[model samples]
Target chain A: MKLGRLNHVGVATPSIADSITLYRETMGAVAIGEPFDLPAQGVKVCFVDTPNAQIELIEPLGDASPIHGFLAKNPGGGQHHLCYEVPDINEAKAWFEAKGARVLGEPRIGAHGTMIFFVHPKDMGGVLTEIMETPKDGH
Target chain B: MKLGRLNHVGVATPSIADSITLYRETMGAVAIGEPFDLPAQGVKVCFVDTPNAQIELIEPLGDASPIHGFLAKNPGGGQHHLCYEVPDINEAKAWFEAKGARVLGEPRIGAHGTMIFFVHPKDMGGVLTEIMETPKDGH
Candidate 1:
């Protein structure tokens, strides 16, 4: 259950376009990826590459999007979650459960196409935490 | 003004000890640092070093602490801010200002003892962003 690198910080935004502009024009970020919709997740995501990690910008894709409530409370967008890589997703889930920490759901394929599961924020010091299996190629 | 690295992600918590336990015991993190109080910042801080970046846990030090209001809103604590390193502090500040982004204050000594300033969340797509000068030693 050893925690790996801090994979990415998920930022929920109202508009990925505007977020891209802020990161590129204002923050002088040059390695931002193009925004793409994840219909299954009901959101659009863009990656802003940093030397150490990436900033994941997410925007709701429809009314029933999972992050709609969050955006309702934070219309301007906000830090949504923190994703940390682990050697094994199942092992991580078992460790969290053993400690009485609530895992949000069964491990499923995440945005990066790796097995991932979320721990309830209440059990994670009020931070939505995602445990992601390290990519097979170690990207 | 090029973004250097994902310096650290600041997490606000009610108790640094509890957060430390979560990271060490539950998350299986072994690089947790001792917690210390920063009277000037009115917060107690601890650094949980990950392979790529660090997680800075901050707890209010007094009633007058700046993060008191945030904690009141999110009593369980939450992700407070994201910090990125820049080549120069003053140059980064001017770059943000010129782009019509509001800098919270003049560059000052931050927890890492490096010159840093914060940009208003409204201008950063709802994320509190800290711009720090690359440490002289580049730790």
Candidate 2:
């Protein structure tokens, strides 16, 4: 699957409020949109737009949230995954599987009403990577 | 400073060749670009293009490489930094400084001949962040 654009960089933070302060006051990232809660994903996400792409800071709401697990292991916030925007989720999954990369989950619906999937950390050289296909938003 | 499009994601790797294969074979990234050696930056970088942005696999060449020191502390590849394309480096640096973020270095020449500077991890909640301004290239 070909990449579209960098959709966002996902970060696991102890507190989204503090993270947003650093991203905005310190890094010059502006709040361009509203926050989204993915109940199924077990996290709340907020976006900060940079010049090139968006930075998504995620804080887990429950014990089931992956962010909670990540924070439990790493303590403070650390660099997480680099998400690549793809055009088609199925095509991307097929391409990744054909290449012997370990896929995390079957293509599923995600934030922004898009289809997304993840490549395991092992196949991606120890860094978690996500591929997303943006849905058409009526203008 | 506003971001442009994402230029690339920097993945710190112990073995560049291994990481490159994963990207090319598994992720469908094309190695259509040349390998760039940034001695001053202390690493050899290979650029692979995806549909939207690029993935840069960085390997430290010697003891002088910062990646080497980073690996010494954290071992295995980790997410390095999210570099945003900026229109003005000086302006961005000033903004960061005002916000109490430690600026790693003055805006200087960086890899791939761009003007770039880094923000200390202390301010970003443990993630290194960079801002870059690229000159118009003659094609």
CA RMSD for every model?
A: 1.0, 2.5
Candidate 2 regions with alpha-carbon error over 4 angstroms: B1-5, B72-76
lDDT of each: 0.91, 0.74
For each model, chain A TM-score? Answer: 0.95, 0.90
Mark the 10 consecutive residues where model 2 chain A has the least summed lDDT: A24-33
The C-alpha TM-scores of every prediction are 0.97, 0.89
> Candidate 2 has which clashing residue pairs, if any?
A3-B51, A3-B52, A4-B52, A51-B2, A51-B3, A51-B4, A52-B3, A52-B4
Best candidate, lDDT: 1
Q: Model 1: per-residue lDDT, tens digit, A1-139?
A: 6768999999999889888888888988889998888887788999999988999999999888999999999999999999999988888888899999999878988878899899999999999999899899875
- Among these predictions, the greatest TM-score belongs to 1
Give the DockQ-based CAPRI class for model 1: high
Give the range of the ten consecutive residues with the poorest summed lDDT in model 1 chain A. Answer: A34-43
Candidate of highest DockQ: 1
Candidate 1 residue-wise lDDT at A51: 88
